[model samples]
Target: MTDLQIRATAAPAAPGTTARPGLLLLLVLTGQFMALLDVSIVNVAVPTIRTDLHASGAALQLVIAGYTIAYAVLLISGARLGARFGYSRLFQYGLVGFTAASLACGLAPNTGSLIGFRLLQGVGAALMVPQVMSLIQRTYTGAARARALGLYSAVIAGGMAIGQVLGGLLVSADLFGAGWRPVFLVNVPIGLALLAFSRRLLPVLPGDSSRRFDLVGLVVLAVALGLLVVPLVLGHELGWPVWAWVALAGSAAMFGLFGVVERRIAARGGQPLIPGRVLRAPGLVPAAGAIFLIMAGFAGFMFAFALHQQAGLGHSALRAGLLSGPVAVGFGLSSLHWQRLPQRLHLPLPMLALAVVAPAYLVFGVILRGGAEIGFGAEAVLTTAGLAAGCAYSPLFARALSRVDPADAADGSGVVVTVIQVGQVVGVALLGTVFLGEVSFPAPARTSGHALLVTSAAIALAFAAAAAFALRTRRAAG
Candidate 1:
């Protein structure tokens, strides 16, 4: 470890010592902002990337999906890895790697190389993110911890909103004649600044060296996820070849294998990545289904919306990005209102939010069919939907945790995180196919209309799953 890492890992300067929680929160939120920004930022630049790199349909999807794939697959393992390596060391390493990856992505000569570097970027994010909550848990207690967590959630939603605007602005400016490259190049300086000041700005706690990891489980899960994601993203474009069918079959088999391996590991008193028993828990499957449906709609909307503005409506990148500002405003303001709500409503809000948001999506689709132009009318609907979107996620997460068996809480949360990622991956892949193949981009309004309708149907399914989970939970309580 470097001197800074050593300093971060060492005991505090004084007993009962507390570093400045305010600064510490800033440090954690910054890391989170960078991670979240990258996910949505690329959406606005997707068209530019395709044209500049002469990317194929599959490569374009890969450019987007690869990062999420790596991040989702490795998140739980990253947490366990931090336990062995120490959060401070892992965090520092992740920051450096992420910075380097950003530079690589900005400088990438082709789509293949960009895809490869994006995956590396995701690896760094996986390492950096799991430590945020761990650090907050280490530094703050009780009400302070709760506030910090709320701030963290707000950062996620806000970052996503900002990412769209930023990407649009960056690409529109064509900075240094670099076009969309700055969308990624922008991360380099921020990553470096974080590296320089992280030791000073962040607080760290001791490591638990006794934690054991399941490498076999990690490998099995990775293969399983790849099997599911790859074919879905590439299948229709390739005419649904025999290989796609093989991959889908392989995905099913790999999932079964993952369960068997995890079960055997737990049977032998080993630390399995996922606990087999949690799979059988009451209401857990429905909860996962609900969360997956919610995220799928969320991810699909981002991918399709950006493309519709740029390719269909002929909006300049900056205008598209600027249009997204209201989404952030709506989400940020609504999130504050959400936080003030009674704690009892937290678990049910996701279902309720999705129920309303579904119609809002349909409403937007109806308006777009008239004209997909980014006018006062469309922007207004986006802001309203943003308010509903803000309510959807936190509550679903709360519900998932509340439904889990106490003994399986840790693994249950871990599974929820993975499922959320998987849902996003599927969303981008499945709906991306629709956006590329079905929608008539030349007809701007029709294109936008079709895409939003797709998202509406997806959200409706999520609402259904949420309704099922709600009924199941009420019956159990009764």
Candidate 2:
């Protein structure tokens, strides 16, 4: 064989004499479970937190927004950090940081402190989450990779479902009269267990010799995201102050500057924080737009539903959580048939399924508003949303990834994930703002149930628009 061919053949596979797909799945799933669970676990605790900390609407918003903003900002940087220091090392350090931050959150005496600790917790999560996907990428190949991704997606759906359930149970249990504290404290043991298991189970990947940290890019990205997201989250709560508008304007300019800096870095033979080429992909832009719309609508619907169940119906945390289980069930069931659907039908099949499912929320709102008490009966809406999500998520993801070059997988994935995060942030901010603003009208006359019905209708409309867009894209592509 030629020298180049020999070298290619001789490149070492990932370490450990034997690697099992099952073990790798276990390790990666555990990490993903922790990361995604933390995202929505706090939702059920929002009321208790407001009471305990004597926090305002804005404070509660911060408690959620702060963590997400920090998490999104650090994701790209964290991936690079893992590459430089070794994924195993970064993953271990992240576990330690996450556990400690969770403890700090549990101990926090006030909303401000809790928000601060949560931001740190998010930093740790950002460090850890990218490694899970990277590890999967490094460990598995071909058909095995596809199977692993399927399992990973299932775990994500299940974990999100369980997080809400667990959050509700912890808040309702009030073990030690801890109230909302246990919601955070529960992470400690899980984090420790993951750390121990991962040390033994995860295979170490070789570090790149040419890797260099992009400090300037990191700073610029952080500032740009903060400027954009912070104002969107807090602006309405603060009554859209003058400074908020300025911050929004500044975000646009900062993002432009970041683009310029990235181009310059690329020209200088350095990797930018985000490669410009990935953003230029035609499929990525539309795919991201669809993701953003879907996420925004979903977040808004869930937030409004949670508030309505508790405040309007006087449901316990556990009860509210149980009411949302149907969505999870639907998602789980639909995912089972997802791989088979595209092959049998077409690209629009899943989107059509989701379209049919979207109106269930509207029906739910009408029922609830018509004096139907919130209980397991609300499962109709949950089921519809879950089914829609299950059918839509994978197909959308596959379409996006199909357009990506094999060599650009990591960067493309990062961009997709970043857009997902951005979509989530925008959803929570915009929808929450609308719900809060609308509810304040006519004071006590506007019940949380009414507010929720309005929000649900709005969400349903948004999803309908998204479904239409997806259909259009399908036609164009065909």
Candidate 3:
């Protein structure tokens, strides 16, 4: 056997007695929800953050996206850490640290400090979030595992919605005159409550000694992402200077090197960050790539759309945040409804979702293309997009892991999530950068409109990728 073979033994629920698996699922979902909330919670508060901190456009994007960058970079390593230590052990620790980081973010005196704290929050999130799936896989079998994953998807979708609403309401309420800080401070009580029960509720699996941590692979991958993102985020502000060009080139080279290093590690019979096999797995590569493109499109559109509402339409932060709430509503409805669906049918959900979303985007494009004023019709369009995303996500997770062995759940979950974060960074960086280039003060509707067209193209690509993956997987099953 090649040294690169990924192997692990998972201990499911206690043999005779059904462990209070419900509580375990609750704990996992709670942690996952909190982490996912941070991703969108700040969207509502972005303008407030910018005004209060005197942040530049680049600084604003960093404040919002820094968490994702850190989370993506460290996730694979964090998964290995969970394997080495224990999933429950890491969950508790990560929860506590995450809570503290939230406090720091609320109290941050400057933009730099806030961004730094947000990155730390990402680290804390990365540590805790992967375990939710790992524990679910470890504690449940068959039907229950499917339910847990569904609930996880529901929480994630619901959290994004709730975050936007709460962020707007909190900032508008101006509680204790805290303003944008409450969006972050709200995590403290929730994290502590989750932490208190984690020890008793979560299963404590023995560390998998067989999995090796490849630090060199981690470093190169980090560098690769940094190079790719830094230039993309900063290129517009810096007028696409020589340094940005250098960074872009270096990022491409670093990514290539990262793959080489990882392949070498696997060839040497050692574990690398991402299993060499996972990349080569049938239907997996295209699915992962599609996810990246779709998220980039989705996230970019959301960011740009938010900016348009606030800056161009003269909407208040609360009002602007509420605009995307429909998407969340659609997502929640679809995911919760799908929980009862048959397993065999789940794989084709994404392909089906694209059919729904394609027309919606075209309509949204036409609306934005109009020379006259657009009304609340845009909300309807966004809600449709949200519904499509919700439809896609739940099934997407299940389908991607369809070919993966249950024993390798930890690594599989980590790899899937890692790609998600990377996709997010790409979305925010490019969209935010592009949005800034065209959006001038006092009326950015035209520029924002143009950006939505770009998003349409990205989403179209996502649809194609999904179609390819669906075809490949369907044939494989047959």
Residue 227, model 1, lDDT: 93
Q: What ranking emerges by lDDT with the best candidate at the front? A: 3, 1, 2
In model 2, which regions exceed 4 Å deviation? Answer: 1-20, 375-377, 440-446, 468-478
> Higher-TM-score candidate among 1 and 2?
2
Tens digits of per-residue lDDT for model 2, 218-276:
99989998988887888877889999899989999999999999999999999898877
Top candidate when judged by lDDT against the true structure: 3
lDDT of each: 0.73, 0.72, 0.74
| Model 3 weakest lDDT span, ten residues long | 1-10
Once fitted onto the true fold, the runs of candidate 3 whose alpha carbons sit more than 4 angstroms away are 1-18, 339-348, 370-376, 444-470, 476-478
- Summed over model 3, clashes come to 1
Model 1 vs. true fold: TM? 0.89
- Name model 1 segments beyond 4 Å from true: 1-18, 276-287, 342-347, 402-413, 440-448, 451-455, 470-478
Candidate 1 per-residue C-alpha lDDT over 158-181 given as tens digits, one digit per residue, 9 for 90 to 100? 676788888888999998899889
- Model 2 clash count equals 0
Tens-digit lDDT track for model 3 on 83-168?
88888888887888799999999999999999999999999998988877777766776556556666765786567566777677
